[model samples]
Target: MKQMLAWQDISRQGAHQGIARMHKAHRDLLDTIELAGRVRSEHPQISCRDIHYAARGQMPRGRDWTEQLLLSCGFRVKTPPRSFTVAGQGVCANLIEGMSITGANQLWQTDITYVWAGRRWYYVSFVVDVYTRRILASHCSRDLSSASQIRCLSGALSRVAGQDLSGLIVHTDRGIQYTSGEYKRYLESHGLRHSMARYAWQNAYCERVNRTIKEGYLQHYTTDSYSSLAAGVCRAVRLYNHSKPHRGLPCRLSPDQFVKELNQGLHPDYRVNIWSKLTSTKMLYVN
Candidate 1:
């Protein structure tokens, strides 16, 4: 109740858009509690700070309130994780920038990567909505099976339910899962186009994102149980969606914000693929 009052007080001083953003932030904060609980149960060994950092994704305000709340709940909230894998050698073998965007949702990229869960190896598959830099779906499993890929893909599709995905171009590397007949039929059934990145650079955007998750997000903590990794990934997804700022979007807007603005009839300042032209002195070029 006190937290709600404080939130309302802060929100009252802002513009309508600012108030809306605050409301959204408050809602997201509340939602993170449930997400954090599920994550902590699955990955029981993750620290409260680690989970909180993953939930907020940036410098947190009103953190004392959170700490007190957790302490009241019998959870000890401590300092943030000191994982510096992002700067360590051999942690990431990919560069962070440089990718082409034809249009929004035009190119969806998929990939698989390996992570260490205890002494065993776990594989994770991710499907990213390339335009907004949002990870639509991800799943980690002991083995890379067509069923796993199907599950991830289905989750991604379900997130966009009731929407027209026609003309969507799905881009992926030449993985067997991507080239498999079942995957091909699924794409065809949805009237979605397909493309493959024959070279590693073609998929660099998703690669960088994956590296960020493994290094900045996942590798920062010591998890006593492998299930913690799954929880970490889920928490990471929520942060990635609602909190983390991407360089691609101005105002540090999240992927969810970009989508919301689009749905609310806000137009982008820069063009994605829409071309403009001025006619020449004597002629105009025609396609």
Candidate 2:
């Protein structure tokens, strides 16, 4: 009775676009997101500060309050809050900037991105082959934990039965999941040379793939359930790897076709390494 009396003055706003409109009694989650949606669509790289700067007077509340609301709406500022830490010798020095990653299994870049399905948020982590531009593997989980990353890598490795991975390198940002003791041990056990990017741009390949998967594919199938979203990601990946022809590939072959032709020696320019030319023209920031 006391709890009921305490909330008697508050009001419940009905749902909007399948989401309940949050207000003072709730924290303005929906309205803040609605404004943020427009800002994000215009500028995917926009930060929380930028959003606040753009929508100054119209914000639901103060900076922190509005930021929290935006976060709940799956809007992460481009600037990650965590400070970079070096493991062993140095992470920045081990970066792939100058390395000759010419083969499919030679270099694998990894990153995690948040996807919204209805009110719930899902973390989708993927590993991309730097050479072939193939999505080697991906794992979708509720939380962005190291376990999920490990699962993704494990699955990728299992599928590399006869592939030459002796010079394998795993590149990722300095997130806790990527830097944890367990993750480091896994890398050491697999004899994988791990590299960490000091700046976000250094890990561009995987970030670009994440954006492509989201905007190019997943955005169209925006549904209210996780299962539907997961299936959509799988279907999209298949289409991307098998059907979508890339201008970079010989005769504009899809990623899977590019690798298949190279294996069969049907690709005329198989000796040419395309790493230098394979970069996302547009800047990609983690959302």
Candidate 3:
């Protein structure tokens, strides 16, 4: 009768294949564990429990192995730290609580964010006209340099050529891309006014646009097998700007719809003014 031996007690002659297989299994497991760590590091808000659940079908793994591998790879299983994020403050403070937009192309808000496709990262820069809530232009690239932002801004300017901007107030966060001297000089030459969000909320409008791209388009359109990050992002942006509804607008119109309305001069009774409502309530209370 043959006796069963513990894994550690296996001899080199008989255990070669089994040992090789076991080592390969451990390597794959460790690779997955390392990936989870990377994900956690990149998105610090993700929890161990979230990783465990996400790894289920993905890794053919059990919770205990997942936990042990994570621990062995120097990952601590922990609840994420509480986050203290607010929308408006710092460089974005002055831009929130209903910044008024008097005319088309008068105000543009811009921001940059990252997207992942397959295994690589990409960047998307957006320019949204505030008054009309229209996405003037968005560009996606493999790099997050100031050049990407400038390219997107240039595209937006080209898209709006011949459009008058007597009182334009272009707003953005204090991201280095927006604050670069090159970007500043470009805006100055175009005769556009600059306004930065004193608080994050000052950039809320742009942030919402970002949320739509990330949560709506990216989450739905992308999969693990995306051919390229740029392709995925470009497709996502095209879907969003042309098809998706804008919640900020009545009738749930898309940016394209809003632009159509603007070009037709169709919004005769539309409540374009934001300050009058606040002023009317104050007058009633005073009376």
What overall lDDT goes with each candidate model? 0.64, 0.71, 0.65
Off by over 4 Å in 2: 1-92, 268-287
TM-score of each prediction: 0.58, 0.62, 0.59
**Model 1 bad stretches (over 4 Å):** 1-103, 224-226, 271-287
Query: Which model, 2 or 3, shows the larger lDDT?
Result: 2
Candidates sorted by lDDT, descending order?
2, 3, 1
Local error of candidate 2 at residue 122 (angstroms): 0.8
What does the lDDT come to for candidate 3? 0.65
Cα lDDT of candidate 2 equals 0.71
lDDT-superior candidate, 1 or 2 = 2
Compared with the true structure, model 1 gives a TM-score of 0.58
Q: Pick the candidate with the highest TM-score.
A: 2
For residue 213, give model 3's deviation from the true position in Å. 0.9
lDDT of 1 by residue, 230-250 (tens): 887887777667755565664
lDDT of 3 by residue, 1-287 (tens): 12445545656565778878899898878677766865554333334544564334465466677767766766663432221232332332233234445567767888887667668766777898776677788887777677888899889989888878776777887766666777778888888777776445557677777766665456555445434555656766665566455556656566677678767887655544433334545532322
Task: Provide the lDDT at 57 for model 3.
Answer: 49
Please give, for residues 1-287, the per-residue lDDT of candidate 2 as tens digits.
44554577432332232244333535556567777777565445555655665566677777787776677667774433332323232233445765665567888889888789979889888888887888888888889788999999997898786777896889998888887888889999989988887665677788777876776567767557888888878877776677554545666567887888777877554532323224635544466
